[model samples]
Target: MCCYVGCVSETAIESIRRSTRVMLLFTELTAVLPIFFLLQERRPWAVLGLLMAGVVAIIVIRVRGTLLRLRGLWEPYSYARVYGLVAAAMGIAVLAAVTGSQTGVFTAILVGITASEFFVARPLGVASRHVGIVVALQSAAFWIVVVSTGHGDMVGPTLIGTIIMTSGLAYSVGLTYRWWEGVLKLEQARRDAAELATTRERLRLAEDLHDILGHALEVVSLKSELAVRLTDPEKSKAEMIEVQRLARNALRDVRALAHGNRRTDFGTELTGARGLLDSAGIACDFDADPTALTTSERDLFGRVLREAMTNALRHADPRSCTVSLAVTPDQATLRIVNDGVAPLQRDGEGSGLAGLARRVEASGGSFTARAVEPASFEVIASLPR
Candidate 1:
C-alpha cells in the first residue's frame, strides 16, 4: 500500500517549543532588576526577600522542566511554592510603600508578573481561575498601599504594563498546541488517499491460474459426477468426452491469463468480495451453480460485482448479502441482495450506480438499483445471452 511522506519536520516543532520556553523563563527572572534601584532606600532584610523571590523562580523553572520530561503531561508540582513567593513579594511591597518610595511599587508589579508566568506554559486547568483571583488581589493591595502613602502617580502605567505582559505569556503555548493538531489531521488525510490509489492498481493486476480455471473446473466436476451415476455405458462415455473438452479449455485460459491478456476474472473478484465481507463481520453467500458465460461477458459482469462490493463496504453496515446468477435462455442476469441500507440518505448514497448503469447500457444490457424493503437494497444487471 502507498503512503504519504511529506509532513512538518520534527526539527521545526522542537524549535518552536524551545524558543517559547526560553522567552517565558527570561521574562520570569527579570523581576529581581528592581532590587538594584532600591539598594539604598529599603532595609537589608526587605532587599533579601526580593532576591529570594528570584532564586525561587529559577528553582521553579528547573522543577517544571523535570516534571515535563518525567511525566510528559502532568499537573505542576510547584503550586504551593510559586504562590508562596508571590505572597512574600507582596508583603515586602507593603513595607517599602510605607516610606513613599516610587521604585518599590515597580518592584511589586514585576514580581507579581513574574510569579504569574510560571503557570502559563501549561495552565493549571480549572485551578487557573484561582491563580487569576490570587494575582488580582495581590495587585489591588499593592496599588492601595501606594495610594495611601501619597505615591498615586505610579498606579495607572504600572498596572496597565503588567496586565499586557501577563496576557501574552498565558496564550503562547495554547496557540502552539492548536497549530500542532491542525497539521496532524491534514497529514492523515493525505496518507489515506495514497493508500486508496494503490489498492485499485493491485486489483486491476490480480489475474491468476486459479481464477482462470474456476468456471471450467466447476463444469468439469458436474460432468464427471453425471458420468459416474449413469447406468448406460454409452452415455457415460459421452459425458467423459465433454469433461475432457472443458479441462483443455481451462488450460488454454490459464496460459492467456499468464500472458497478461485478461483484464478481469470472476474467481478473483469473488475471492476479494469474500475477504472484504468476512473481515467486516458480514455473512456472504455465493451461489453454488453459476450460469456459463462467454469470455467477454465474464469480464464485464466481474467488473459489475467489484463495483457493487465497493459501494456496499463504504455506504452500509450490512449483516448479510447474497450474490447470484440466473439464466432465462435469452439473457443472463447478475443480482446482488444486501441488508442494512440506510433509509434517509438519497444524495450521493450509492452514487456510483449511475455511472455503472451507463456501462451496462452501452454493452446492450440493463442495470437497476432499488430498495426492496426498509433495510434492504438490491442491484441487478442483465445482458443478452
Candidate 2:
C-alpha cells in the first residue's frame, strides 16, 4: 500500500492501479493452479471450468489499460471493484469445489476479500468503521458455520483461531488507512496557507505603489500650475525644476513597485534622503553602519526611513533633521528627531506615523513617535530578534 494518501496525483494513482492489477492477476493464477492439477484425475470438467474462470479473471484485471483510454467512466475505484468481484468469484468457486467436504477455508477467503474492498474503494474515515463491523460479523458467522459442517479434516479449535486472526488483520488494515487519510488533509492545508500568504503580499505591494505615485503626481501637477502663473523667469525655472524632480522620483518608486522585490539598500535610501532634504532647504544628517540584514528586517527599516524622510520634508519644516541607526546584540534601533516640530502637528491627522507604529508592533517590535520637548518631535523603532 502507498503511504501517501490525501494528495495523490492522477499519475501516481494510475501507476498504483497498474501495478495492483498485475499483482492481483499473478496471485489469482497461483492460488487456482493447485486446484487445477489436484482435481484433474477426479473431475476433469471441473478442473477445466476453474481454469477458464481464472483466465477470465486475469483478463478482466488487465483490462484497465483499455479503460484508461476512455473518459470519466474510468477511475481507480472502478478497476478496484473489478478486482474485488474477481476475488469474490474465486472464493465462491473454491467453496463449490469442496462444499460437501469442507467449507471453512473458502468461507474465510470470501469474507476477507469482500471486507477489504470497502477500504480500497471508499475513503478511510467513515468506511474504516463500517468495514470493521462487517468483517467482525462475517468472521463470527464463518466460525459458527464451520462448526456445523462437522469436517474432521479441519480441527474445531483451529477454525476458531483462524477466525480470530482474520478479524484482527481486517481491523488493523482499516486503522492504518485512517492514519494515511489524515496526512493527506494536512498536506492540502499547508498548500492553502502558502497561497494565501502570496496573495496578501501582492495586495500590500499594490497599495504601497498607489500611495507613493499618487502623492508624487499630485505635487508635480501643483508645481506645473504654479509655474504658469509666475511672472519671474527665475522662479518659474525653479518650479519647473522641482516638477521634473518629482517626476523622476515617481518613476523610481514605480519601478520598485513593479518589481515587487522587498529588498532595501539602507545606504541608497540615505543618499536619496540627503538629496530630498537638501532640495527642500532642510539640513539632513544620516548615520548607519554597513552590514548584511535579513530581507524582512531590511524592508521594515526601509519603510520607517522613507516615512521619516517624507514627514521631515513635507510637514516638520525643521531647519535640521537627524536620522540614526543603532545595532546591538538583541535588537536593531532607528531614531529620527527634528527640532522646532510642533507637538500638535506631530500628533495631527495628516501624519502617517500612527500606521507605521501599528506595523512595527505587529512585527514584534516597538514604535514611539511623539513630541519630547515644546518644539521637538521624535520617532523611534526598536526591532528585536
Q: TM-score for candidate 2, please give it.
A: 0.55
Error of 1 at 4 (Å): 13
Q: Top TM-score: which candidate number?
A: 2
| 184-208 per-residue lDDT for model 1 (tens digits) | 4444455566576677445433423
Please list the C-alpha lDDT of all candidates, in the order they appear.
0.60, 0.57
Off by over 4 Å in 2: 1-104, 113-136, 152-194, 207-215, 218-232, 256-263, 274-299, 308-324, 337-379
Full-model lDDT, candidate 1 = 0.60
Cα lDDT tens digits for candidate 2, 102-130: 32243343334334434543566645565
